[model samples]
Target: MQQITGREAAVAVLNDPRFVVPPVPPGASGIAWLRATVGRFSSGPAHDRRRALAVAVLDAVPPATLRTGGGHPVTVLARALGIAEPVMDLVRDVAQAYQPGTGDESRADAAVDRLVTILGGRHDEPTAALIGVLTQACDATATLIERARHRPVDEVLHADPPVRATRRQAQVATTVGRVTVQAGEVVLVGLAGGPAFGAGPRRCPGWDHALALVAGALARDSPSVHEGTPDTAPGTGRD
Candidate 1:
């Protein structure tokens, strides 16, 4: 709602620390969208449009801004920036629900709500893929939630990667690492830098955001769990 120029707003957002992730090592795929959007607003149309674009971009693929690789310095800087990864997962859930092949309207709608709560703003194409990843995790979590609707999660576990992920569609693809599954909640890890699944603090903030977001989703969708009932139901159990 603040009426700042796009260039100014983008610069401000980039510097906000809530968005920008720590820079990863070379040979890693940085967020192309974030770099381009920032470049565009760096010098483009009027300030209002730039501001709107800035807002849209932030609302869209905010996860791109989260720092993933580097070291404690980056993590420390990223956290100081308020640029944690779990928040991005909330954006992702809503984006994925809208995907064409997902085939679950309820899930999509729920994702949209989750996105709204997380971003508290609009959406765009740039953020769509990230959202899709969130949605996938939501779907997988939903699957687990449904299976263990009456159970409690005693422990959180993670599974090592059995195979590498292939790149093709606009989904979160991993090559190295493992998959995380806890009480039917499953996610990919160790791809690129950080399992890229939103687990640890030093890895891809995108995945971290996704994991936190899905955990919330699972709680909401299952009243029993939300109400403090134990999740004793059997689940995937991979961390």
Candidate 2:
């Protein structure tokens, strides 16, 4: 694996055609299927379409609303998505298992099944897209909230990013910085050194919504409400 730093190099690696996200296996069900189907793990045109769908979901939930809304981030987000009942626990479970090697997948799959039923009966693209939104917002937003306690959120993001790195695979032999990375190698891009959100096609679309959630939490709840929480890396979908 190669480690990439600095904003310019990060941008180059992110936009380079020879590098792509390491794709999850297809032909899966539940969380595995959601992992394979979402834009976060895909590249190229599939990513474009899926990301657009995700953006459309975010589009429906204005950041301003989230900034002033009441409730846990997951609950607020779920309600914003038009879910009436409480699904915070379910969303958190799915988010915990959304990334590879994270949690009990059976529980997460069952959570995904419930979420699917809540959104709409069919497990299709739009439903998958909404799940993608909730999963991405989970730990990442919480980590941001914790880190922003003293410093401004902008500084917390650049100087001390909650998710410090993002992984990209080299599809072909490529030179990143002074190092020549071979095909099938993984390069860890240091988000601490890069442009905000991200710098290329996979840039986060729900940034405003994320920031708004963080701000709203800061305004609504005391930090003690989150005391003694287990340390977790932000969800793996930083970009």
- Supply candidate 1's per-residue lDDT for 231: 29
lDDT of 1 by residue, 102-168 (tens): 3344544554545433443434433333333333333333333343433432112122221111111
Candidate achieving the largest TM-score: 2
Error of 1 at 26 (Å): 30
The per-prediction tally of clashing pairs is 33, 0
Kindly report which residue pairs in candidate 2 clash with one another: none
RMSD of 1: 17.4
Which candidate's lDDT is highest?
A: 2
Q: What TM-score does candidate 1 get on C-alpha atoms?
A: 0.25
lDDT string, candidate 2, 1-239, tens digits: 57888888878887787878888888456888888888888888898899999999999998988877676677778888888878878877887777677788998899988988888777888888988898777777777788787788989888877676778899888787787889898878777754557767788898889899988988886543234334455336455
Worst 10 residues of 2 by lDDT: 222-231
**Model 2 / residue 168 / CA error / Å:** 0.6
